[model samples]
Target: MKATIPVYDICTVSDGHQHPDLLTERLGSYLKENYQRVHQQHGHSFYHLVLFTGGSGSHTLDFTRYAVEPWQLYFMTPGQVHSWHLGPETEGYVVHFSTAFFRSFLANPDYLDRFPFFSGQSPDQVMEVPEKLRDAIQSVFEQILQAGADNEPDLVRALLLQLFLETDRHIARDGEPGVPQQKQLVLRNFMALINRHYRSLRLPREYAEQLYITPNHLNALCQDLLGKTAGEIIRERVLLEAKRLLTNEQKTVAEIAGELNFPDNSYFSRFFRKYVGQSPEEFRKSLN
Candidate 1:
């Protein structure tokens, strides 16, 4: 298979200019006169929060496609591959911000790891925004766009936080209720650790050890919250990266296996097939 999915940083789409720490724009305009690029699978170095206020379509993250409608919101974290196909009438607000912008807002480097929406543990990435709340969210996005013109980074940062806070409230209200906070914390920590060490560590026990929890405890937490064992969660992360590499990078299967720390190509092939339902080469070919 050819390398069809390229990982793009903000600069790559901005005429080779450096990406601003935070930026906002109308979704339709940002995609420009030709909107087909939005349908191409790609990865980003920045986080994306897109709110659609008109029309309908679908957005795919990893291998799952999500339905999108007016007044719906979607979040995409850095390193996740996503693509969209929205109707031509679609109108929305899009906010793009870097990791540095988020880190500057809070002392904790992993502050974003706590968000339930884009985190790997969450299955639902799209949230239905209440009609009453749309105006407020729109105002915040407009403020961020205007703040950019004034070159006020601090103002943009503050408004961005407000937007996120409001979105969080809506998500919490609409999401599954009565999930214990302790279970949420364990899942969050597990996702954070996976993001940090997915390439070298493939074992659930490794993550459990670092979190100072027993392996069984970690597995139980995952089973309760995500309906999967801790090891399955780890493999899910690994499989995501494996698919990304197979589709984006030019490396052969064996080389990719070695880079991902698999002992041999066969071992990697078996693991990939077990979770993804196809051999690595077959998966790559199917992408064509």
Candidate 2:
């Protein structure tokens, strides 16, 4: 029998190019058959917004899975382990860019604060754009593809900012009144710290102390807006990293455990099994 390879391991782009900017307009038609993009214990470090224009499939990002269908938009943030099981007839346009791209547009460290799509919220708020909005998105891509052959950084940046703003507008129109700005700032800081130290700092109190807030307050705020405790958020972040390491990297469980600051390999195995419902090795085999 032929072996099924994992998607991340094989460069999905044609011409063996890895840069997202270069691959922007190119359609990756072979992604459906080339790999089983599984969410092993460790996740990824890039953000992708996949827009499904036709066909059907199922996608899992973080802990939520959605049935993919026509005219659906899915947001996959950095540090989340996600997988897409495309139908035999799946068709879509995907816009993939790194956080570095945002830096060029916003030019400030706090720029990410403008967008809620990156906040790691559950039931990921992916809006199904109306035909009008869809047309706008397509037009941006058309302009991007037609803007002279030269590398037009200015045009590219403008289109990207427009895309993000449009996404933000949709989110605002759909979402309930979010947490207050001060509290949101605190939560954003807490999230950033967790992203930086998820492997080492597994406790909410660890982050609370660093933020100079009590654990109880942090938990209350997270519970109020996210419907989960702060500790649960931390666990999700840790598990996301664990999934990325297990699926995307070649490291052994013991090596991953040590890196994540688990006391022993067995403990990490138990943690992975509890949340992922599979042993680390079993998850890796499923991807293969």
Candidate 3:
């Protein structure tokens, strides 16, 4: 049998949604029905953000574990892998939304991408809500919950944006040194490119050529904002996908190599060993 990961959409988790684009609910109620799946490794077809006002456990996103603590907020873009453990008393607010959620409401379709937490990088996806701002953020989530119950998509959308804006203001506040808008734009484009073409175009120069920038300039942009060279970013993406596939036990190592378009299984094994510090089979065994 071919192994695959579970990828959920709005309807799969909830029903009777007049607004199919967004769903907000108390995390406890959600867990009452979804506890099993929530603990299993899976991906979502929509953006998922949760604020833990009261929780004790952990959330694992793309293989990185984050402690579940009060006032912690986590974000996930579409297609990212996530799972969690929870205490019986765990409670919070969770909002699941689709790309279409804001595209119709705002003039800019990519506006949500501007927020750092929504970047889907595991490190950037988890955050501790600032000490003083916890109450206000909690209130905003309450408002969103009420709006969601009323099936008011517009209000829900606006409040979500407000929540993001308020959180980003304080969270990224260390004067985030006003990176040039152009540089930010380029970085976003580069990341998008990497996601779209990492399997085939593994070279930074190839991306630079597409962006009409030199390889050095591309590396500088990545280094300045992301603390990694452009090439490393591309390789990280490839490795992430490889790991995701490896999580599916039915797939053989050579099959994964072929799926990733590696020239041969030996080359793929070498690459995995060089970075992952173990053979693919060893990694799979560790998971077991």
Top candidate, metric lDDT = 3
- The list of candidate 3 runs beyond 4 A from truth reads 1-3, 16-18, 172-175, 178-183
lDDT of 3: 0.84
For model 2, the superposed segments whose C-alpha errors exceed 4 Å read 1-20, 26-46, 62-64, 77-83, 87-89, 98-106, 119-122, 130-132, 147-150, 172-175, 276-278, 285-288
Candidate 1 runs further than 4 Å off: 1-4, 15-19, 33-36, 103-105, 120-124, 172-176
> Which consecutive 10 residues in model 2 have the weakest lDDT in total?
2-11
Report clashes for each candidate as comma-separated counts.
0, 10, 0
Ranking by lDDT: 3, 1, 2
When 1 and 2 are scored with lDDT, the better candidate is 1
Q: Put down candidate 2 lDDT per residue, 152-241, tens digits, no spaces.
A: 656766776777777766543324355466776687788778777887788888999999999999999999777889999999878776
Q: In candidate 1, what are the lDDT values of residues 200-230, reduced to their tens digit?
A: 8878899999999999999988887778898
lDDT of the structure predicted as candidate 2: 0.66
True-vs-predicted CA distance for residue 81, candidate 2, Å: 4.6
- The prediction achieving the highest TM-score against the true structure is 1
